[model samples]
Target: MSSRSLPTRQLATVLFTDVVDSTRQLAQSGDQVWARLLDALDAVSRSEVRRRGGELVKSTGDGALMLLPSPTAAIECATALHAAAGQLGVTLRIGAHTGEVERRGLDVAGMAVHVAARLMGSAGSGETVVSATVQALASPAAETYDDRGELSLKGVPVPVHAFAIRQASPPPVASAPLPVGDDRDAVTRLLRERRYEEAAEIAPEVDAATLAEALLAAGGRVEFLDVDITLVRMLQDVLDRLPADDAVTRSRTAAKLAFELRGDPSTAQDRRDLLDLATQLAESAGDAQAASEALLATVNSLWEPTGALDRLSAAERVITLTRRTNDVDHELEARLARLHALVEVWRIHDAGLELATYARLAARLDRPELNVFVASRRGMLAQISGRYDEQARQGEIAYTNAVAAGMPDAERLRMSHLFPIERDCGTGPDLFEAGLEMLRELTGIMPGNFYEADVAWVLLTLGRRDEARTELARALPPLLTSSGYRWLFSAVLAAETTAEVGSAEACQRLYDALLPHQDLLACVGPTFGGGVGERLGLLALRLGRTDEALERLARAVGDFDEIAALPWATRARVHLASALRSAGDIEGADSRLAEAKDTARALGMARMLAQIEAEDGGR
Candidate 1:
């Protein structure tokens, strides 16, 4: 079998370490002392490797071999070991490299091992050297290097480029504990000075009112916009310390905390519970505006509890409360939330009208940020409405406006608003020919592994089945098992790719993950053009769940038809027809196929039309 067919082989970082002049040390020191020293080295090596989430493969008397999850992790572990060696009164040489390694139960093999071994030989005492691949992956992780140029290595087919790590890892910062009593004054002072991280450390020591005030202050800062795990823990501690009697303050704090947890899949249930607590607190205190704000957060949650219909109800409640309290901002926020829900539920025409109202209100408010948001939603509307040119134009407007407004996520946001549209509109680079490295470079600005599924989809579409399957294997597990803001887009895209190239186990896993969300549109914020039910249907068909497949596909067809999403409707009909044919419903199959052909032709979906024509041959 080819090396490519071996499932155990995968990309990984390999590290090799050696104690300098071990032979001389053993000769000078006695055998017993040298043995004791080896024990000490082994103790330190095990601790450091496990601390950095690396595997200590084996000890080689004078040194050891290790495997790490990434080149950055390997570099970290190597540097840490270097520091520890100094404390042990010994010098060491280490080399780390990243490449394909085949696991053989307890040990790893292949070219990466040999390269790493050679790299260790070339390293000077107390130095850490790494291969070019490791340097490339680790450089972006914020480490400086000294270029060692190229060298010929023993048993290597070509010359290898190497680099020596120059920068030492910074000492971990220890946060000072807060005072024993309430430190509201200290918290307020820190927040006002924009030292939010410091303030968060002491947030739990403050009373409910002070915590609420800190929340509002921190909410306005761009630093708090991104996920900070430490900050999240600090805020959760603060909420836990607050008294339940202080309904108003607790309500606001809980609502704010829910926003902080919005995009994370691990906090999905926590976010729902927090919003519920906030809503109940506000209603009990007779604070309509606060209650409205809490419900609005729920409406805007990345993962809905009961899907779009539930959000619609929450949005309506927000609207009712906003009207009672005369809160224009909450009212507008609720309306926009409702608009997105409408689209998600396949009420496209209603969503369009809601968009018009939102645009007018945004202009009246004269908020450039809100206008940029409106432009993005307009792009979604154009996409589902089958106005490809208009979709492209609106996407550009949103992208340009976001950049001009200096949004922190301007480049990342372009991935959501314009990347998929560009692919379909033929106005962007040929993704099929662009290759994975260029794709990574294009999306490098976007932080997270979710884009891996997006790249996999392009590979699958371009007929690179092996590459697509490899990426799908890497990207599917997390998306299938976790819940997050981008869950819909990532899961649907993975499902589509998986149906084409996935193994049986992967297909089953994706089908299970997506089944619960089958009724909602496969969207990221407002971007995906239509129903995820279609992808779910395709997965069901692949898994041989015939009845479920037909049910899902037929439901998707109705949804796209309801929204006038002609392109998606055409695609779903084709798939549905294929499923029907397999189920031996010949008449039903012919009817669906003819309808799909008509719609695909009308919408100028050339690729989809070709797919319909080739349904009997193979899709």
Candidate 2:
């Protein structure tokens, strides 16, 4: 019934994966244990296959034959599954081949399948390998993949472009978690992490009385996921037994409730009521810090827009409470950072200053960790002000110091890319190198996806399109991607670089097509001559909307002007001289071109001048 007389040809990637050492593992284990392991493995495999757009065709014995919509997805699925199942002593090898295939029976059969099987044969024991057909689909995003020239397949007609997966291995300490590590101080560390509920969980796991004694001394926040309502009620009961004047204990209780209330609506109203009571008790005790903590708990239940103003008023109450009771604690500093993040989004400058004062105060406190945090906040403020250079300089020092002191990977990579953008090349190359290295080794790390895109941008600027393309290729598969927007922006910039280097109409057409995305416009525009460059480009194309160009560029100083980009937004002009030239005003064109060059000289963009010279060369 589903048969069609005519069959169409398309490039499809076929992947084959077989559980490595599966039989050995089973033979060494009890049959029951092996059975559970196999079932779980199959479940994970099936879910991953479906998510990656791979259609399962057959599962005979130890291996499965799957048809993937794209080669990239096949590789990604293979790499991730290898990591996910490693704990169970199950590893997988994937081989992908993309080419024309026949739709027959319940599956697609063709040379692509045979080649794919062969490719799989060529992969390392636990590696994922890819063929050339998959690599050629480069129009969507530029990717970095090494070209392994023609590989001789047993029966496939020719050699295919073959590549291998590369991933960074975790350190010896992190390769696998231990059954029990040195956790005598687990409750204290949990409290320090603001994981109140987690602290409570482990508190029982350890000595609860000792944990409680330690928490009373350590003074930290708590974390509670809202999924367990019964657990929260139990935890709340425990908190109710604690002394009201114990600030850290009260803060931890409030924080746990806040996380729960923010995440779930079933107990929202009740939580709000509890928070208000907590606030009152805190206020009555002249404990504004505790009251502010309670107010944060209340804000979570009302985070939605309809009640946001109410939450904001509550947030402001923290600042007011701090001022009234004069609690100069780190909580006040964090509250300021929190409020600034909110007000900055609304473009409220006065409110931002009030928030910034707290950052300055925190910086003066001089705790290394708090200083690092405050510096990062200042960098964010600088970014918001469009002073990207300042952001990079200040943020880089803090992030670098943090990393030197063994800060997390997320913070390190953040500073790396920030430096490159601000033209602080000190750490730029190393940042990109580390980023790419991470992508290859720990592909499953959530933040690796982000670092890949950003590092790709820097690589592109370095004239390493080929290298950048490799990184993009590894990251841009549509499987569980948050990389789409960045991919789009990167793709266009790559295309623009091609256009800028040559006068090719094809390159120009690609740039012309992608000009509409506002982010892309903003990104490419500021790097060039002036604001009018885009309008002038449009005017040159003369795609029949003369009025649009005329109206848009009317704010220009003249037709042939280029001094429009600036630190001098204080003074700039646009020009329509070129448009008039196309409209038959030769004298006006000469005058405009002269003026534009003179203005560009004043603006001091070396490349911008070169572009003008190249345009003259073409004429």
- What CA root-mean-square deviation does each model show from the true structure? 15.7, 19.4
lDDT of 1 by residue, 384-493 (tens): 86777777677778778755543323444455655555444443346345444434544343334366887798787776789888988877766665554455667788
Name the 10 consecutive residues with the lowest summed lDDT in model 2: 1-10
Q: What are the per-residue Cα lDDT tens digits for candidate 2 across 304-345?
A: 222334455665676677667666552453364345324312
List TM-scores for all candidates, in order.
0.60, 0.37
The prediction achieving the highest TM-score against the true structure is 1
Regions of candidate 1 where Cα sits further than 4 Å from its true position: 1-245, 256-273, 283-289, 300-302, 305-307, 321-328, 368-370, 399-444, 584-591, 616-619
Error of 2 at 337 (Å): 2.7
Best by lDDT: 1
Q: Could you tell me which 10 consecutive residues in candidate 1 have the lowest summed lDDT?
A: 1-10
* Per-candidate clash tally: 1, 23
